[model samples]
Target: MSTDVEINLLDNRWDASVASGMSESELLLYRSNVLGSDKRVTNYGGGNTSAKVLEIDPLTGEATEVLWVKGSGGDIGSIKMDGFATLYMDKLQALKSLYRGVEFEDEMVGYLPHCTFKLNPRAASIDTPLHAYVPRKHVDHVHADAIIAIAASKNSKDLTQEIFGDKIGWLPWKKPGYELGLWLDKFCRENPDADGVVLESHGLFTWADDAKACYDMTINVINQATEWLAQKSEGVAVFGGAKHESLDVDARRAVAASLMPAIRGFVGGNQHMVGHFNDSDAVLEFVNSQNMEPLAALGTSCPDHFLRTKIRPLVVDFDPAKGNLDEVMEGLPAQIATYRDDYAAYYERCKHDNSPALRDPNAVVYLVPGVGMITFAKDKATARIGGEFYVNAINVMRGASAVSEYVGLPEQEAFDIEYWLLEEAKLQRMPKPKSLAGRVALVTGGAGGIGTATAIKYLSEGACVMLVDINADGLATTVEALAAQFGGDVVRSVEMNVTDEGAVAAAMAETSVEFGGLDILVSNAGIASSAPVEETSLALWSKNLDILSTGYFLVSREAFKLMRVQDMGGAIVFVASKNGLAASPNASAYCTAKASEIHLARCLALEGAEGGIRVNVVNPDAVLRGSKIWEGEWLDQRAGTYGTDKEGLEEMYRQRSMLKRSVLPEDIAEAAFFLASDLSAKSTGNIINVDAGNKEAFTR
Candidate 1:
């Protein structure tokens, strides 16, 4: 092996003091978490780790050896003690006696539950048998990119020998199941001195009689392979050298922002898809390379990679040298259509008699030359994770193609893995998606009570939200709180003044790039001013009109432009006020501005009807609690006007309502949720009064 390459290698993170105190099972969890923390070791949900421990059998009152392994669909990086499935070692070994042949191996999964120890409810993954029959106290199966680079080469066996000598063994490709598990046991029996093996077009498996030893061996083996590949491939041109120069960072992002929404529209024919954009150095290098199309066409080599990213990505016909984004936009629909047809053809050519009915044929990953990669999926995190996996594949291809011919998994093999009956069964067990699972929303004035409440409601129902506010500090606090509740992936914030035309347009672009596109806009940014007609200053009147009427128009106009590009109908909910309809004695400017907001919704409804866009109004009255406006001078002014103090103002408003109930931010949120959801799909240009029975604001 060459020694010229000097690169950052994987660090051995096992602290002796820490490991000395942990129990055997806790050590397994600790080892798995550390390995999973770095994508260089394994991609998310792409590996399994296990340890055999002695436990008292609940049924027989005797000490027995049990296997503790990661459960199905659990990510090692975030898994807890409950995430592991425990099974009796004797039963798992005895399963070999029941296995008839490779063809009937899938039936073995049905018996895993029967082997459960202590009635642990976690379902064992298909990889359980591979770990079980290894004949070692600890085992780790990880899809490391370095090992896969060697595994995916045309002469992978030769490369494996050149890198690790006799320390690690090799096995040919076999779809992971009971049969593959037996193959591993047989390999271990034959190669007694070997510490691990690399599976062709699969992943790496390492074992040790000690828990820490297994982790050390796993990390050491991967590091060795990575260093060797780097040395052998040093000074080699990546992806056959770049075919197109990379666009400047700003231009690349602009191109991605332009293409994402249109592509989202085409692929979202069945269900809405959130988008993720990646312009990292690796992604830029690959996308701007000469071999990008051919390598992408080969699809991913690992089953885990293809399972997240579809079989292959769709290569967009974009050239940064020409800078013809408009032309690219015009051709996106046709390009997307061709991709679907090709995917369908692949399914038809490789499918078996019992393959699951054809799934959504749309491509998950999209490659734009000279810009970056765009991925669309059912939700934001999935889309972003899919991009990360593709980047991993890019790394593998770069290393493999540099030293040896990079090879993809056979088309039939990839199809079998994707459409396997076992995989299909797992898919069927997933929970139904939430009502707004794939939708994205932007709430203006999101730092305030009503805006924050509306965002929380949308996020609860599975929508990605972009919170827009002018208060920098408040926006940051609100974003931090929401991110804590709903993860940072689904919540984003932008400080923007809705009245500025330029700010409104930039916010729209940011939303497109942030979450693919927009599906709902809750126009809730406003201020409350209480002054008699004589006392109201020109400045106060202009402020109300500027923020309430003109601001709403600017935001809606930009939203319409973006939604039109997506060609998917959207919802626009205007949070007007009950005072817009009921004339108050001391607040002409506030009432007139709000009335303008209500009328704007009516006009937008008339114009957006043909495009399937629905516009509606939610009129709220005396929302005193949890409202930023009510916390300021507006509270004192309103209390003075009604002859009540701050303490009694809420009760005064409650008694004035016909239903004698106080209005809160949550009430407005619920109303906004209805208008934005399918519950009000058929109703447009309508008003839902959430004032606890305000006759003056009634929309009859």
Candidate 2:
């Protein structure tokens, strides 16, 4: 079962070049962002970041002195500038040396005479000294899933030596912060040349002169551990061999939900859950194991993981052979009570000089026999984070031991960090997503043909869209075509001119903001202008550009800017004519501008992709509908100029295309919405043609 080949870690040395003039916070933040990409070193909250500030931003004129460490609560993956806390070096140093006391919460808060939390906005992380103690300029820490899996094994300590020979250093899992730092300081001093260090039942740490170097070292350590685990647990057992006939998934989730408060109280929100209980004779047998004391031995892999995954998995003893739901539910409360009591006792024993009592835990995962794992979150994201951590932890533990014995960091220590006030406060200031639910979007050119049909399609999907046109009378009539199909909010109408930027921007911003941020923006505003090239005048050219080309750009640019900073990305569609693709006579400026409009969409597509924003252009053949281009005055005048009746002129436009039928707006919106949804996560930078196979398919 072992992999064919394993990679050996080559990085262990610290290079001076890696410590270039970056702020300690910047370097550490940089490290966390890069390291989070690795699967083994961390999962969600499996790691932390830090840095010492050598200088202050002079322009802000704020105190030039401070050290900002990763806040008490945050994911290492997207840790931001505000994610780090600022503290006065003097106060932190003093607190580190504090002894037994009455737990002066104010003393800890006030200790930073030079650092003010509220005034600075960024508070410092509690484990500040752990970073300060490292003589190296940068430090990277992680709950290396592989290393911990191996380290936690009774055989791992010796196995690590067996596998790596001399490069790996093992530290018995110690409570992190000062004690761990002191122990680490001594070890580093002893083995100045060791390549990497693994914490027993904890994670791994690798630091180098640069971000890539540190990242590469973490990957190397993991690949080695992965190979080792595969060798050891080649044919280990998995959960769910026996079925719990009576218990369903929901019943298990319900029982866990009832008991979650005890586990959740330690962490704030987003708990990892796993339902490992089985109707299987194995789980029942294990629950009844003379050696298996689920409560006493179910500690987690590391203390840092406490925020997402509580100290233990809820190991249910549902009998596959027998036992009803009521019986299992009846005993769950007692187990929950035990978890709470253990948490409280842990706080009393491990709390240092002056931290406040713990808040209830945030999230705890359960291991109910038969039912699968279920996680709880303030929202779905955190729940998944916590749940994934526990599931991974269980996998590693199972691999680490021939029969792994649970040994997590002390409850008191886990609670100290999990309840750290400095951590909770940092997670508060982020923009939540706003993807318009139960709201309507009103597009002016809804049905004539292209715009109107497009609007109809948007209505088909969930949006309440108000379709509009210069021919308000026609739009009202199409309501009958689309009426009784969905609720009234699905579509609406308004008469407006795209040439009026103020009115357009105001109308657009108002309608969508009033509804919510606009989810889909299709600026298919235009007019089809045609005249003999020699006779075209300044007046005609100006009107065409103002209404057609310039109008679409103005609307699209505004939509782009709105979607860019809206915090969540959105989709945009432009309805360019086939004329925009090729060229038509007497229409010099119209062709030039339409071509320019296509370029505008292409540029916005490039810039907005960074924000998950998508820009798409749809080209359609001539459509005789609500579009002013295909409407009365101009079309008749152009037809007269062409020496043909309106019927003949219409046929002239349709017959030119392969699909003889005119393209409708609904057809355009269908293509637009596809690019807007989850279907197009990888479909950016492309133009979609709802045209009836008119142009040769040349892709950009």
Candidate 3:
């Protein structure tokens, strides 16, 4: 409830630097980072900042006032000097005269670019004009959660007035453009005493002659709102305990497993999709609250959120203990159809002549009682961002509900901003996303050399991967390394025996829940057993078949079932060995088991081809550098057979190949990637040899 700003941290970092020397632009960049680093002030790329500074015009070599504002697609948290787009202040100010009823989408957007100081200044932020119009050297804007909670309430104007007195002006939600900028300029001119402006249901804006003052003002205003809300809800508990208690963990997992595939299929469309279940304490509390339905349907907390979360979430009815998934499945299609129909109607009701084409009408967030929330998107990043936004939204709504009824922007108003060309153009300006951007992949024996390499390859191509292995220690180490490289959300680990049917099924279910659906399965789990047929024990032969052959079958069968449910074609790659095609002495058991794995892939290819599911195999040989299989007795045995030390054995195997090259795990990984990707769209039931030049193992 304290309305104090944390100015000490800034003082510590800036006091000495300020005394020495700091340019206006550098100070602005430093302040922008400070503001953006706080999630309470800005979430992701949701805010903009600027500083008006004197700069020498390149052509004239004379000092001129310029407005440097955060550029489009630039994250304030990590922005640099180049991150701000520079525009001539006089030229931008002169644009006010031309805004005589000129619509933002029509002539104003086209004119703003002409006022830039440079030929092609970094695409100026959509709110560039708002900053230019604010009569201050430094300006900071943020979608502060505390301010949002108050600004989005039913009586926001009164609440804002009560908290900030007449020192703050209130502007009704207006799509950011020329008109909005002009209106703000006129308002400030009239109400010179106001320190800032609150855009109803949008965000807050504060400005001052100094960067520190502007940042301090932002924190102070947000703190005031937070304290007011805290005082109002001191003793009142708005969200009562759940009327329907949460189901046990086991039952919840079962419910998620049963319901996720159908939901994934219904919303997948043609693009590969993934789902993430967020069961954090906040999410669970929100889902289980007595007023969950009404508060959730109220609408998104802000207009920008619409682009990511849609207008409202889809709320499904479920009694965790008594609900029948079959019944839920039977009604799901109709529910989705209705959701789409309603969205289409909303578009029809709000569409303007210049509005962009309607986007697909699918709910990005799903609220299920006793199971928490499920956020869906084409890729993991978007889904995770959407999930985080919703969690913030829930908190805002909860706080606002305790003070006053939560109110979002009007539907027509939201539509205007959602389809605004100025906003839509930002998305178009982005580079094309990766091919496997939103797909989920599962790899068995993911701690091993070939499996680890293949997982990294999939991650590099933008797929979220789940690494399954029975080696708990190795799995933990591998997952930690990969997560550090590709972000923790993009990589996950599951320890389970692929040969265990129950465990494999559970793992597949976990994958589906963690990431919406499985699109790629790499059956790379195997054990190397070298023994002559006569010397091989019944246990040794059965063990090889169970892991190398049967394990592949179990994992593939589970993946195929999920892919079939998703109805989206998937890819499966089996890491077999060159010995499968050409038998090796003292490796009878290993050869037979690998051969069984190859045939299993072929049979799967036939059955899966009709469903657009591709099944392929990669045959690799002597990948000893990183191979865990080459450790201990296996290393000594191979070296002895080659009549030299382990080091010499690697060279001996390399020279045996026609190419005289060492077969590395990365080499096999490359082939697996091609088969997993669309590069092999027309290919299935094929064996790609990763061996350098094994003529005997070549698939002819």
For each candidate in the order shown, give its overall lDDT on alpha carbons: 0.92, 0.58, 0.84
Residue 576 alpha-carbon offset, candidate 3, angstroms: 0.4
Candidate 3 has an lDDT of 0.84
TM-score between model 2 and native: 0.46
Q: Tell how far residue 293 is off in model 2, in angstroms.
A: 7.4
- For candidate 2, the lDDT comes to 0.58
Q: Write the per-residue lDDT of candidate 3 for residues 373-487, one digit (tens) a residue.
A: 8888888878888887888788678677778888967888888877877777876877787867888899998999998999999999989999999999999999999999999
Give the distance in Å from residue 238's predicted Cα in candidate 1 to where it truly belongs: 1.0
Sorted on lDDT, best first, the list reads 1, 3, 2
The per-prediction tally of clashing pairs is 0, 54, 1
Model 2 residue 555 distance off true place after TM-score fit, in angstroms: 42
lDDT of 1 at 684: 93
Alpha-carbon runs more than 4 Å astray in model 1 = 1-6
Give the CA lDDT, 0 to 100, for residue 54 in model 3. 97
